[model samples]
Target: MTVSDQTLSTAGTEVADGIVLTDVAASKVRSLLEQEGRTDLQLRVAVQPGGCSGLRYQLFFDERALDGDIVKKFGGVGVVVDRMSAPYLTGAVIDFTDTIEKQGFTIDNPNAQNSCACGDSFH
Candidate 1:
């Protein structure tokens, strides 16, 4: 189903299901792609283990999708999540923020039963 136009910003973009891309995040990603001079790259989100909280978040730019990947498109951007990471990321919202103390992409995940104090890891 198409998202309601009223829920979108002036850019005519709608936030994805359980996900969001703040204006700051979208601009940052766009700038990065421009600087890299590669228009084919897309953001890939994944879950891995290595943090004190038991699970860690992984974000990267990739040009191709591997087997068993779930793909979602938002505002002309492609987001890919692998099979293993799907459950953990379900109902998660992704946003970008630029505050005096922090500046980067952030994920608001409802599925996290526990998270590290630094907010970099989850369980």
Candidate 2:
């Protein structure tokens, strides 16, 4: 409901329950939103069954606020995590990295016991 100022860099900002968004990640999100010129979308993070390990992380922009959706904000960026995916994402940190080796958003989840080598799935 409340929107504040910008970015969390290396450290992260905690969401409604336990998920986190690093400042750089937030800035990237905000940048994306600005590029799209849409204010109704929120970054939705969810876990779905599939992938090599078992469950896979899903991240995307969403406008629908489903029932049981958990919402939180980091600066002007809003984030939503469904009730079912909440537990799996506990203590999870979402960050953006742009090194010569790799570039993109990454999730660091403490709840994952085992993740596939390709990094797309987890158990």
Best by lDDT: 2
Model 2 misplaced stretches (Cα beyond 4 Å): 1-12
Q: Candidates' TM-scores?
A: 0.81, 0.89
Instruction: Give candidate 2's error at residue 116 in angstroms.
Output: 0.6
Compute the lDDT of residue 75 as modeled in candidate 2: 62
Clashes of each: 0, 2
Q: What does the lDDT read for residue 10 in candidate 2?
A: 38
C-alpha lDDT of all candidate models, in order: 0.74, 0.85
- Report the lDDT tens digits of candidate 2 across residue range 30-61: 99999999999999999999999999999999
**Model 1 lDDT per residue over 2-117, tens place:** 21222345453345544555565666777887899988887889999979899999999998868887766655566777878888887787777778998888998999999999
Candidate 1 residue pairs in clash (backbone atoms < 3 Å): none
